[model samples]
Target: MTTTLPRVIGPWMAAAVVVGTVIGSGVFKKAQKVAEFCPESGVALSVWVFCGLLALLGGLTIAEVASRLPKAGGNYAFLRDAYGHWAGFLWGWVDFGIIRTSSIAVLAVMFIESLNNVLLLARLQYPADMEWIGTGLGRWEQVLATLSVIAALTFVNIRGTLIGGGLQMVLTALKVLSLLAILSLPVLILAFSPTSEPQPSASNFAPVWPSDWSQVNWAKFASAYGSAIVAVMWAYHGWLNITPIAEEVKQPQRNIPLALIGGIALLIFLYVGANVAYYTTISRNEMLDLKGTPVSTEFCRRLLGSVGVLVGSLILMTSVLGSLNGNILVAPRLLYAMGDDGLAPAKLRQLHPRFQTPSAAMMVFSGWAMLLVVAVAVAKETSWIDEKKNVFDVLTDYCIVGVAMFETMGVAAIFVLRTRQRELTPLLPYRCPGYPIVPAVYVLILVAVVANMFIGTEQRTEAKVGVGYALVGGLVYALFLRRKEA
Candidate 1:
């Protein structure tokens, strides 16, 4: 059995991991929240564009960082090499226990929700009372379905990263084509068949600015814009995920940068284009009014009725599954790196004898994610929460502040590592274009976002909770894991 993971992922697959993982479930769902916060089409579009640009800056900055410390753990490696052992341990700790696992659970639940849509469209329903040992979970069928997907994807990734990467490429292609269809179909229908009923109209683009712009309160607007930016950032969250598997990429120096910059450029285009298509198809006011149905589902339903829903749901399910696969493929490598560093159980570092993948790490990550899914279900059923949030909302809110903090720190690591470049082993082949300015700007914006999250009423509780979770990791490390270093 080889102890090393093979460098099997090429440039294209690496890029697919970036684009595919970031696009999942966000544009379809979070756009509504963005629209609600921004209201005006122009404001919402600016938020999308602004967030995309920040993400691109982040990508460009991280490219140099990844090249300098090319390793399996991505940001964990960066934080460790740049700061110290405990910094890295905290990232791995929060990531495994909160961020990444919660992400997997959220995506799995979303996939199941899309599946439910398909079934409902087909007039098929699962047994209403699919009890799970009489535990009274929120919805047993959905919960079980979520676990099945997380498990299945874990198995696929356990087979090999190449297989997972290949699957990501195919799903990425399908999702891109699906998004293109969503972006183009409305215009095509209106252009070639102007007499069609319920066709997309030019008027949907009106009121580009809010009617109350003259009376707007700058303070309230800033808060709302900050909220919208966080949501949009979620849509852009996975851009750096590809870096986690740097050890498995064919040429880390070349491929990782290409993946980072090129992938983010494409994502910005696709995201903005898809949102424009949605707003034009369904007016801004209508989008704000939408409650249960996602904006994408509504756009498709309007465009092609029942058939469109099926198509949209299938596209979403595939997109989400692709993201899930990418997450599973990359996240375990972080745990493996942590184990290799003695921050986690040593067993997590073991690779599969035949597959050369982090089998133990994959199982642990997926199992925890499944547990989170169960936790959400039980919480809801037992009235543990005041609001009627789904697994996705609850988990995303729980982890967003932590994600923002780490991501900011990861980018900021650039400055610290630069001064200590001689001590770091690998010489960087790629340098960030704007150096101090690029990373500086990205860090500042994220700092503002994190601050806003703490200030805003809705996100304040979650932000505190997320920070508290990370602080607890510090306690765990000081008491137990820190002994390993001794």
Candidate 2:
């Protein structure tokens, strides 16, 4: 008999998972990129808001589907059931091997890197001479720290869903409070004391539209807008992760939808408000040129001097840790789902006897992520690699095309199941708001992002990689399934 995971996560923890996972280091890292692409505070902020709306639309639609079919494989389950088993299998493979596992490595790297920032503020000479992945930055130390954290979290989660839920709650709470601090401190300093060192001027919000928008060059605008959207999309990426653990959620019908929508709504508020705080401290061009210095660090440096720098680093560490935990928790469940269906190695389907957790799958997933970390570290020094892009950026972009494409399928599954599967009609306890139009818009935007990928040179790297990844996944699945049958 197959062991089953217990329904231990409540509405609040589920929602916290949603919030914590989405608001990672990207908000701090990519806020500047958005400014680089859009430049004009008005257009830049508009892009952020527009992306939030798109995320919400996608969330609401996904919430409906998740509620209808609350299962472990969330996206994989939806795709398999709606399209075909093969469709879901490939998504699982891509997510496990590339998108999600790389995200874990990246978030862990960011976490350790931020922790290093904290140490530096304390006048610590720790890792002063270590440099393996990059020059003079203790890249080797960062890699070790990242792997240790991932290993620790994996063990904590190995206990069961209940323990993981508890850890998620605490991390999410700390992350949200830190973000609020980022938002509030700037406005507070501006409100109370203006005569102080560096305060935001009313002039920072000027030139509300892109300086080049008046020109009729569609190519430039598309490139700029697409790049900005990719950055924003990075921030909005993990809201869907909540659905993957839906089977472990108590009252999955109500909690799933509430967590999905509420978490994203909260994200919208935090993302936009955080940028307002960022712009309050740094001008658009300054934001663009902030190489090596984290945007949050620069913001905090301007606010509380030395103390703010430590605070900024701590905040980033907290955020990345939360995101890392969420990714680790979600990906194994996907493997468990696939394995349960005979689509993956049978060992992945085995749940721990006492814990009822997908312990084997978690280890497998972590092992893969560890390999990616080493691979990225190696790629950082390789001559053929793009000098401008780091391992995180390259890995993230490689999956961008796959993520956007799969997201469209997941959303469109709402439309697919609602019409094609008569039996599932009764299962949809929560109907998507706005019916066809809302999801249609979500899918259309994703379609545009995929199309935009082809048009932009920088984006083409990820696009070509994504296409090749999908094709390879399909080819591998066919062979694997054939071997199983044989």
Candidate 3:
């Protein structure tokens, strides 16, 4: 039986989903990592901006594709139409098994951790020896909080798309406002505080360039940029989420491009502005010292005192929570799409009769996500994995590799669609702006990222596991799932 769904999301709603998804845990926590590799504030800022431009270009290309094919199963639909069902099935397989779920779980855990930090700070005046609820609720407490948030949001999604969309919109506004406040705080404090240092002179404003090309190993620099791109691209990754709800968007063709491009532009501005603010107040050395430490909160505390710490924590929590919500909102549709294709159990496609939401699909997703959270948390608690390497880093390494594989395959799909369907070309509403050149550049950058995955000492196992998972996913689709469907 065919179901008719409501067009509850418009351009703004779609944009909010994209922005909310992209601005998650990365920005709040990843700057120090970026700073670690790039060293110079100017270089770090420039790298961020460059990543934004890359994201913009990728957005432009995908927008053109999305406008042409406004379907539920984003890259899956694109691959299916361009290549065949086998390719589409593989795409969906990787998406469901690895990329999307891992991302959501990682972000959710981060949000919980951020909130826990805020709560701990609030209770700081309590006697140091006193315990609120045995061991005083640290990381494990954060996990429980995260799971609670996930459960609540899952209920919202299962209840109805309208409620889910509304929550997204509200949270998106809060997140943006929080970011603006973050950017403005240092300037405001400098203006009002008697102890604030004077603004630097013009010479100080000049961008720092790396000198001594001999000291800078070109090979090492290339490898580092490649590695950095994985993190950078992850930060910029979710612009494509808009396409999943394309059918639910009013004027899908026109609005899809606007949402994708607009969201990327907004993120670009905020990222650059925030990084500039970060550099202005804190020395490069300070940012570097805080690498992989809980020092971000401490940095804010030093700059704005206790008030700043609270504010920063609130902003980070909201940012990650909004991001988790965005993921929850979009991920179930992948399962629903698979069910519709007869690749997955038909039960997953069932929509709530009254709410008109994918209740079954969302439930399955939430269950799987909860399992992942518990598994990772248990591993940490048992000391099976080092607490120093968080679940976020581990998942990111896997996701980066998975996403790189999909992106590589996706870029290839463009050429395949062009060559295989020459006669159907006139029907496409949008086309890539720079034709071969633009897509070619995207492929080059993606290749660089994949190569860089092997270069880094950190997160190497995660990267290997990611690649292994993708390969196994492809094999599963080929030998079992694809054959059954065929």
Q: What shift in Å separates residue 49 of candidate 3 from its native position after superposition?
A: 1.4
Clashing pairs in 3: none
- lDDT on C-alpha atoms for all candidate structures: 0.86, 0.83, 0.75
Clashing pairs in 1: none
Over 357-456, each residue of candidate 3 has an lDDT whose tens digit, in order, gives 8888888887788778888888887999877765676787677787777756666567777777676567666677887777778778877777677666
Error of 1 at 161 (Å): 1.4
Minimum summed lDDT over a 10-residue window in model 1 is located at: 129-138
Q: Residue 136 CA error for candidate 2 (Å)?
A: 9.4
Give me the displacement of residue 130 in model 3, in angstroms.
12
lDDT of 2 by residue, 123-241 (tens): 53334543332332477777877788889999988987778878888999998898888889877886898789888765777777746656847778777888789878888898898
- Model 2 residue runs over 4 Å out of place are 124-137, 211-216, 382-384, 422-427, 482-486
CA RMSD of all predictions: 3.5, 3.1, 2.9
Worst 10 residues of 3 by lDDT: 198-207
lDDT of 3 at 379: 88
TM-score of each: 0.94, 0.94, 0.92
